[model samples]
Target: MLRARPKGRPKATDVELVDVVVGAPDAGHVRVENLVMSVEPYMRGRMGGEATYAEPYPIGEPMLAPTVGRVTASADDTVPVGALVLHERGWREHALVPASECRIVAHDDLPPVVHLGLLGIPGMTAWIGAERIARIETGDVVFVSSAAGAVGSTVVQIAKLRGATVIASAGSREKAALARDLGADIAFDYHDGRVTDLLRDALAQVGASGLDVYFDNVGGDHLEAAIRVINDHARIALCGMISIYNAETPLPGPSNLIKLIWRRARMEGFLLRDHLDARGEFEAQMATWIRMGAIRPVHTEFAGGVAGAWDAFLGMLDGTATGKAVVPLGTLGAGTHGGNDSLDKEANR
Candidate 1:
């Protein structure tokens, strides 16, 4: 649990590991042994003890996040023992949760971790932004910021699959290369020079006059730059602002707000919780894409179970992890499930 609201950039001392008792579930609940949990950038906001899209994590209480596990004991017959389930009580080894909060993962062939990454909130956010909000079309020139991260990587692939030319930006050369490998037409490191200059050069290289769609994961400089070169009636989807997630004080807005009026462009911010109606469709389409090798899920896994989740979260915010950062707690045998074996091999190298 968080010691208190962070004063500035959060530190390891803000959270501590304490022993707790796990009691058996009541009539409509089950006891889950968590197998894997997701660590994402948005979680940083929750720790600030301020209201946002989601409720703030109370001080001195266990943090919650999307988790995948198996039901070890169940009081509800509908959710049988040993059934794989997805819930939102992570940062712990065992969670006693209502059966209604558990979503059974029907696909037995895929790795349990998949439920916390590509097929989870991150992937769904990308899908909704690209397909519904941005409405990316063939021939459209799209710009995706933080293009090597979890949501941005998925947005890059979805734009390419829709026949849009993609311009990707990342923090480092290695991550930039990753964006290109994932099918971006041009990928650049944001640390190279001014973001505006880099974006202009990328657009010129692709022979695009201006951006048709912008998927923003990193705000601040990236948002300002995208606004500077937007085409007439362009669309921008505000997925996240990882660049300022750890700021101590309020940051300045983009200086180009007037450009939206001049360009007749539309920019909208979204939350995945509001779009739950589309989850079934998104999951089905993504599953097909995965099986056909049209889309790949990218993530970095930490091995020390629940205790490692904090480090994984910190690493993600510090830009140390390439894609999604995940913590696996249980032993799910290899080759029995569908995970990215090629990425594992590359990590070993």
Candidate 2:
């Protein structure tokens, strides 16, 4: 099942558990005991044998991702024992990583996964895309696609925090309701009918003069709709394109791109890593907002055994999972109770 490059059906087939030797930190490396690593849509693109925004996962090498782990050993003085660090430890159980490559996650009132979700890369993407790029302002109208997912949920909250009237689109009625609970001014089901018609109704009801900001998470039709509804000088933040990630062939471009010229709308694409220098300021501000109940990180926890992890990932891509899709990597016999592990107990202190 292992492949040097992806062939047919991009999946997590190259899974293995090899005994990894932890060498002494070589000046810049740190040894970590990983707890949880996220399986996101971007990982699927890396396995598809295509040039992407990020590096492709190499064959016969450990798959890399942001993992929340404890620093068991350190080669750098800046990172010490028991320090909860976020690093690209890949699929393995542990890793030796460069000190500068990881962030020192101080265990505060937040859980380890928050370092991956809220305070993590996804959180930054949602925040910066909405706050800085979208420039969400009070009384502005904002629309977010994939509004029930991780980054989408964050975008909904961030837009609300800035006083923007928010509208969100989800794949199901259930997700739409959840999006409403997360402070979205309006939530529509993308599966109901023509998303364009639903968007028009939402704008008419809200009395919006086009949209001030469009936080696009899904591309293709969603992008086309946002372009048509954007007001002059509206800002569009291109976050991700989950719709086209798995297409066997390249999909068509937006047919309504001409609207950009007419509306004078600005559409810009950016990876979260580009704004690393400003992350500290953003994180600190978000932490204070979180403490004040101004923001929330909505997540869905899948409890199936390790064997069901792949199914969970696919479920997320298919738009079947609500909120932030997460499969908890817990021991099978860890607890007798059956339910989502308390988010309050594990995440928020």
- lDDT to native, each model: 0.87, 0.76
Local error of candidate 1 at 212, Å? 0.4
Which candidate comes out best when scored by TM-score? 1
- 1-349 in candidate 2: lDDT tens per residue? 1255545444555554333355556787887766666667787877656677777777677667677777878879988878878887645455688999888875356966677777777788898898778889998899999998889989999888889899999888888998899999889999887888899988988888688889999998888888888898899999999888767778998888888889888999988878888877988987887778888777765555334455666777777766566554433212212222321123221
Estimate candidate 1's alpha-carbon lDDT, on a 0 to 1 scale: 0.87
Where in model 2 is the C-alpha error above 4 Å?
1-4, 12-14, 17-28, 304-309, 327-349
Off by over 4 Å in 1: 332-349
Clashing pairs in 1: none
- Candidate 2 structure, TM-score to reference: 0.87
Worst 10 residues of 2 by lDDT: 335-344
TM-score of model 1 (CA atoms): 0.93
Least accurate 10 contiguous residues by lDDT in model 1: 335-344
